[model samples]
Target: MEKLTAIIPVFNEQDTIERAIVSVLFADEILIVDSFSTDLTLSIAEKYDVKIIQRDYEYSASQKNWAIPQASNNWILILDADEVIGSSLREEIQSILNKKSTKTGYWIYRNNHFMNQAIKYSGWQNDKVVRLFQRDLCRYEDKRVHAEIITSGDLGFLNSKIDHFTYKSLRQYVEKLNRYAALQAIDYDKITDKITAYHLLLKPLWRFLKHFIIQKGYKDGVAGTVICFLQAYAVVMRYANLYLLRKKN
Candidate 1:
């Protein structure tokens, strides 16, 4: 059989590390790249029989790029610590590897849950990401926030969904917004001229409107509302932080 390896990047994810690692045991090798987590994340991962690679914290793209070459197998399945693979998804992945995959990488539709609610209207539908790929054909860009895998060949989507327990509570959502905003600010700082008032204000409102109305956040009720609001707030913070960075420079 052609070798398939699962690669996961983690940071202080003690709550979900074990499940994440177990989900990929079907692979020839399971490799986890750690960012010096100050929790039981390392210990939990160790119990799962995965090869652990330690490195300092960095952006998502950088971390994933660093992990790709470390994989022992030619094919790699990249998964985040918070994501879980259902049996259907696992079987789908195996099927793809068994034959010639249509594309250099496979994009999986992600299903994210917020506060125990499956938020349908929060603009997260058919959230496709190219995580499973031939190790030599793909790498992620260096964007600090909203990083995505870069692939040269055609893209194909997996029918099964990768479950993402993205937010356990409103607080977690807020914290992520703040963290991502800071990263985006730093990421955009290099472009100095990109910071503008519209991004700081109008764009955020528009984002909220897009999510709450265009994307139909109303169906998810409170969780959808919160998700849209947090997205808008993240937009505001990104520009605000960028503006400050520009002022300092």
Candidate 2:
């Protein structure tokens, strides 16, 4: 059987870190890459039988890329603090480890939830990520937000899903979007010389329409509608922040 290591990178996720660690206890090694969280995150994690390391917070891609090679095994499973692997997924992964698989990576779909309710739409219905992969065969794209894994070999998909408790409340969701907008603004600043009405107005409106109408966010009801609007707001905030960032520079 092949040994697998689970790498969970987090910062200030004390409320969710323990559950994340507990879900991956099946792995031969569990490595917690913390960004010096000034909370009970470290103390709670210390209770688990897992390897722990600390580093200053940077962009997501860089942090994940730096930790990938440090894993004890070549086969790696990366899980976020807010994601939990279900029993079917765990069994499927164990089955894969018991054999010589041809694929270098596997994509796992996420069942996203907001305020304890499952979200079936709002452009999140088919949310999938390359979480299980060989450490040597994959690396993340150089983006601050929404980084995709770049793999050399062919990838396959797992039938089971990961339960993603993305946001506990509306306040948390808004704060998360605000932080993402700020990080995304850094990348936008490289290309945007100026912000105009098109960015501030049309783009946000289009974003809202794309999600709420085109993507059928209405199907998910109130949560979906709110998420779509917030998504558009995030776009506006991104460019607005880019404008300020450029001005400061």
Candidate 3:
């Protein structure tokens, strides 16, 4: 059998830290890479038998990259503070570790929940992420938002899924959306020069249409409608921020 290490990166996640740690207790080692959280997050983590490391966070990809090599095992499972590993997923991970697998990484699907409700659509239905991977064979892209894994070997998919409590309330969602938009704007400013009306208007409208109509966000009811609209709004905010950056420079 191969040893597995679970690495969870968090910041001010006192509310969900314990649950996240408990879910990944199946791993041989649990590593909590905290971003010097000024809350009870570290206190809650101390209660567990996991190794805790603190660092000043820059971006998600950089944080995970810095933490990955510190793992005691080659097989690594990365989890977010708000995500829970389901029982079936736990068993699946164990089963995979038991076998002689050829793949270097596996993409797991996420069952995203918003406002305490499972979002069946809203372009989040097929939410998959490469969380389980060989530490030596994979690294995340250097992106401020939506960083993807770059695997050296072949990748596979898992049957089990991770339960992600993405947002507990509308306020939380908006807060995160704003933060992400800011980061996205900074990222965009590197490659983009002119932010025009097309970016602020047409792009956001297309985003809403793609999610609500093409992706069938309406199937998820009110939560879906709100999510789709807010996603488009986030697009507008990102472009607007970029426009502001352009104006300043």
Candidate 4:
């Protein structure tokens, strides 16, 4: 059987980190990469026999990428602290370990919950992510806000869902969007000098269509509507960050 390591990165997630840690207890080892959290996140992680590593906050990709090299196992499952894996996914993971298949990665579906509602639309449902992978073959891209894990080989998918508690309220959503917009602005600012009206205008409309219609977000009702609107807002806000950057200089 291949050795399995679970990698989780957390920051100020005192309310959710414990449950996330407990859910993945069956792994051979759990490695937590944490930002300097002001809450009891460290204490909760310590209670679960977790090996903790401290890092300054950056992009999600940067933090997790740092944790990857430190893992003892060749096979690692990367999970966000807010993500929850159900019982069936756990068993499936063990099955894969026993088999030690040659597949380089596995994509798990994420059922996102916001405000106690399992959002069906807004292009948030059935989000598949490459959570399980061979440590040597996979690496995260260097994007600030929306970094993706890129693997060199074909991937597999797990049938069960990983719960993503994405947002609690509108304030939380706005707060996070501001942070992400700042990150995205920095990334874009470095890559390109200026933002055009094309990106500022067309991209947001496309986001709404992609989520609300193409992704069947409309079927998700109010949750989906709100998600699509917020997504469009996020696109607009990213460009707004350009204004901030320009003004500061």
List candidate 3 segments past 4 Å from native. none
TM for every model, in the order presented, reads 0.95, 0.96, 0.97, 0.92
lDDT of each: 0.85, 0.92, 0.93, 0.86
Compose the digit string of candidate 1's lDDT tens values, residues 1-249.
568989999988999888888888898899889899999999888887788899897778888888899888888898888899999999998888888766888888899988887766689985778888888888888898878778787778889999998975677768878888888999877765765677777899999999999998888898888888888988898888777777787
Model 1, which residues run further than 4 Å from truth? 190-196
Ranking of candidates on TM-score, top first: 3, 2, 1, 4
What's the CA RMSD of model 2 in angstroms?
Answer: 1.2
Instruction: Give the clashing residue pairs of candidate 3, or none.
Output: none
Instruction: List RMSD in Å for every model shown.
Output: 1.5, 1.2, 1.1, 1.9
Which 10 successive residues of model 1 have the least lDDT summed? 188-197
For model 1 the local lDDT of residue 98 reads 83
Cα lDDT of model 2 by residue, 6-75, tens digit? 9999999999999999999999999999998999998999998999987887888898898999999989
Where does candidate 2 stray beyond 4 Å?
none
Error of 2 at 110 (Å): 0.4
Query: Which scores higher on TM-score, 1 or 3?
Result: 3
lDDT of 3 by residue, 1-249 (tens): 899999999999988999999999999999999899999999999998999998999889999999999999989999999999989999999999999999999999999999789998889989999999999999999999999899778999999999999886688879999888988998999888677888888999999999999999999888899988998999999988888777888
